[model samples]
Target: MMLYLAQTTGEPTGGLAGWAIDVIDALGGLGIALLTVLDSVLFGALPIDVLLPLIGYTASQGAINIGVAIVCAAAGVVVGSLVQYTLGARLGRDRARALLVKLPGIKPESVDRAEAWFARHSTKAVLFGRMLPVVRPLISIPAGVERMALPKFVVLTAIGSLIWNGMLLGSGYLLGENWHQVVDIMGYVPYALLGALAVGVPLFLRRRNRRRKNAATAIVETNTSG
Candidate 1:
């Protein structure tokens, strides 16, 4: 789940992928989680999309427990996502979008689109965006801007991230050494993931709309009681 952008940084550990592997090998589950945290927070990209399969391959060699690795990764993503969401909430949409534009590797169009999408879909964006790349992080921003209920935001992020992370980890576990190093995690997703999304999106939207209504009812009740 953890990876420094090997493509750019030339391995944070040392001279070769060998050293990189050594670091990952030595750290195991904790390493995976930590790496994922950074990646989810925009620190790196190699972790989930590229290194996950490697982690699985190593696990197949009995280097780490696949189950533990998966859990750690999923948890890491959730933690990191919450951080991003909190940041967005604190910054507000305009400030956040402005900051994002100044940051490297983030597209302005992506930010604009995500904010617009959130305006329409609100929580549904949070629920499903975790599985998306640019939208995944930026949607959290708008959710923060709109002041989404924290518990609901985290829960939805966890669910979406779990599905996304689980697929990547499982694919890595299955593909092992044969897995390709995907430079773009969102753009280069596995076919299995695409298939899952095709089926899951509609169902997610349906459930999300229902949840939205229920949440409205809860808010009214809370206000009435107070």
Candidate 2:
């Protein structure tokens, strides 16, 4: 995907860091925005950190304007979100069930669970689900398959997508050339969170064991004295 973005922006697909900068140089403001939106909606992907740095570089080079870049990026986000929403509405659930049957380890029960979740939460699921990586795209599928009311789906999707995209893109604009670093940091976030949990679990167990030992000692002392 990064390579494709580089190619679209007229950069040689060599190193991502250099290619991102080069692409911004080649594409200018409108080009960057168009590429950002196209990647997000159609492909359901975005190289947010890389693109922002490119935008910053373009701003530095005087090849593109920042305000224009922001507008274009936001527009692209909206366009991409709409495409995904439409796809979800169109594909619905029957097709998903058919596809699920072909996949290994995917069961009908899981599909039912998904449908039930959507039925129960509906709006919250659609909105919050957009922020989750794997869940975001999958949420759309059930929404479509169930024939969720078109207006409601659109409203929820738009709101969730806007918030998600705005935060990322806005960060890009604010961080400027260093924006890619934010992406790098984000990439490690999941691993860091997992590591914290791993360390915390053992510590919690040790503390619980010490408490149990102390309680047992206290009870023994009381009974012996009695």
Candidate 3:
């Protein structure tokens, strides 16, 4: 609701979320699809929860067809997930786990749980993981490491991604201007990610630079002691 209102009415665009909404509106289905593909890859992309609904909300405005949005969004996720899956298969368990678990924003516990879940329900893991937050990406890697059949991975990913995309998109389509509330209610991972960026980024840089300052202090202390 706030999405299009900000566009036509005189309301302020609500920061990054606002920007993404506007981009989706401007770019249409293809643009939204590209964004999803980028989001799926290991590279930093906006977020599925945020992007899908925003696009869906815009669809409610009749800017992009909901069907088109779903198709493109799901397609992008499948491609991106396949990339990670391939990498995971190549890296194998030990190396893949070592590198993937350490990535920024990846919780080691979530990765562990995803691995365990994959162990028990390989197909379900890929399907359900498509709908989760951090686990979404993590699950793909483990499936790859486990060398789950590619056909099954593709099928599960497509179905799951489509459903996931539909829910968010439908919320926006149905909720109209109140679509933002859907994101607020269901977008914990997205919010957490935003918080991490807004707060975590600066903190990390400070910690990194703090090492240099401490080393300088240590040099001064050593000279004085000598």
Candidate 4:
């Protein structure tokens, strides 16, 4: 597999992205595993969504096996998340959050929200949380603080990671060389969703208000008739 990775080369892509590609090309599955571990622990710094697809694209070009890439990604996730889980379990909530806050790019409020998500979802938070942005990396900490069973946590994390990683990987495979299009399009997703909410929320409120007014009018008319 490492030889396979080395054989597949491209014109140099500049910047951090280029550096990442070089690393993966040089190190193969080990590179994927290490990057994913960072992705799992470092909040949004590594951009796994973009990286996974690139791996897929490489696989499409017959560089590395997609199945192996997915496995490596998932394994990295498990290892990174376990690091966080252990911290939470050992340090407890307050101390863990304090330490996490000191880490680069980690927000204190994000930690708060992750705890809230766990409180609401309980055991299944591990499953669904893996799919959610922002919450994905932090969810493991709360699970640790609460001392959820290691076996259950591992199962849920693996299943969720596999589903998410597989989708990204599959998308890359399908898109072929145009996989960068997915990243470009994804950049606008947040804005698109916000635009939808901005339009939909007011429209929904207006319709709801109109319905209530009509219902009140009908009641008044019926009382008068009576």
Candidate 5:
């Protein structure tokens, strides 16, 4: 669900976002952190990106401190992401894939691509993948499945979360009353990502199949020679 802030009052006065604002006001930075945790662990559980900028807008109005907001949000994201990673680790690949593929918007193919991406990129996928929208949460699954070092996973997740949070918060602070403009721009991202996936997934599958066939052929030839 999306939260809209009232431009005149600089407060989220209605809807889910407004409810979150009420909580943030009552609990301070910790509230923001908790919400961010929800954002990461549960798909579509909260509109955290939108909420972050609104928090930034609040900071700009002197209602909250920007630095504190950034720290709390980033910390929350890391913690939430860890939960997802642990799920993957504990579930292992086959079980994890079976469960994940059943989630409302999660596609079986997306899981396949995430695993493949991690196979190719290893550590860098954990580091950089945290910044991408579709990949951010999903990437953690692959990391956990591959048994990435806990220390390394935390460090990379923290770094990426900080960068992602800082950018949104900074943009909200700068935009001030006009922060919703960012929301407008973000709305189109899903469509763009869909187009990319539609094209990319097929190509990825073809390459993967070709590689497997080649490996199989090599094995057959080696056995014949023996």
Candidate 6:
């Protein structure tokens, strides 16, 4: 993705970037906004692996224009999130529970914990979740299931989505030609975090199981001695 963006914007093939810039310029206000919204919603909903750098590079080259891109992307994100939330709400808790039971490696208790968290901090969770990589999409599912207020959800989601998208686009713009490089470097952050969790999880589970076993042995010893 980074390479594609770079190649598209590079001198030899800079025509691609020029073409995009022309289109955005022609669209003026409304066209740019529509592009921003579409790009933000569709890319935001999908995995960040491909979308972030693409947007970053394009934004950096001024292909999409920063201000217009931000507004459009924010709108797209909020709209996509609302769709997910509505579906979850329509399905309700019972349907959600049934689906979870059939899915492997999904802990019902984890879903419960998420629900509890959302109940206590729906607005904060939903807003912050929009900035996170995978959590952004997942958070909406529970919010919908809980039937959170529409106004609050839209307000929070829009604000967070705008800030998050703005940060990425702004970063690219500021970094200029090297914006793609910056995005490439930053992309590893998520992968590294995931790798740490993969290794840490087993160690954590092993320690937990050991503690449980020791506690059970202690109980048996005390009963036998008594």
Question: lDDT tens digits, residues 1-226, model 2?
Answer: 3344445656445664454445555666556666666655433344554556545544544555655666665566556656655665666567656765465544566556656757766876777655554445356567776677778876786677666555555555566555556566545644654466568758987999999999999999999999
Provide C-alpha RMSD values for all models, in order: 7.7, 10.7, 16.1, 7.4, 7.6, 10.2
- Point out the worst 10-residue segment of candidate 5 by lDDT: 1-10
> Cα miss at 186, model 1 (Å)?
8.1
User: Model 2 off-target regions past 4 Å?
Assistant: 1-33, 40-71, 97-120, 185-226
Better of 1 and 6 by lDDT: 1
lDDT of 6 by residue, 1-226 (tens): 3335545655222443444444445664454445444433343322332333355556666566577767866776777777767767888877866765465544566556556656755777787656555455456768889788889889998998787777776776677666656556655654665466568758987999999999999999999999
Candidate 4 local Cα displacement, residue 50, angstroms: 0.9
| Native-to-model Cα distance after best TM-score fit, residue 170 in candidate 4, in Å | 0.9
**Using alpha carbons, what is the TM-score of model 4?**
0.74
Top model by TM-score, which number?
Answer: 5
TM-score of candidate 5 relative to the true fold: 0.75
lDDT of 4 at 147: 98
User: How many clashing pairs in candidate 1?
Assistant: 0
Backbone clash total, candidate 5: 0
The C-alpha local distance difference test score for the whole of candidate 6 amounts to 0.62
Query: What is the descending lDDT order?
Result: 4, 5, 3, 1, 6, 2
Q: Write the per-residue lDDT of candidate 1 for residues 81-128, one digit (tens) a residue.
A: 777788888998778988988878787998898888788767777776
What residue runs in model 3 are displaced by over 4 Å at the alpha carbon?
A: 1-26, 43-45, 184-226
| Residues 90-136, model 4: lDDT tens digits | 99998998998998878998899899989977776788677667788
In model 2, state the lDDT of residue 137. 37
lDDT of 5 by residue, 71-116 (tens): 9998998999899889999999999999988988888888887788
What's the lDDT for candidate 2? 0.59
Alpha carbon lDDT of residue 46, candidate 3?
A: 64
Q: Enumerate clash totals for all models, in the order shown.
A: 0, 5, 1, 0, 0, 3
TM-score of each: 0.71, 0.52, 0.72, 0.74, 0.75, 0.58
Clashing pairs in 5: none
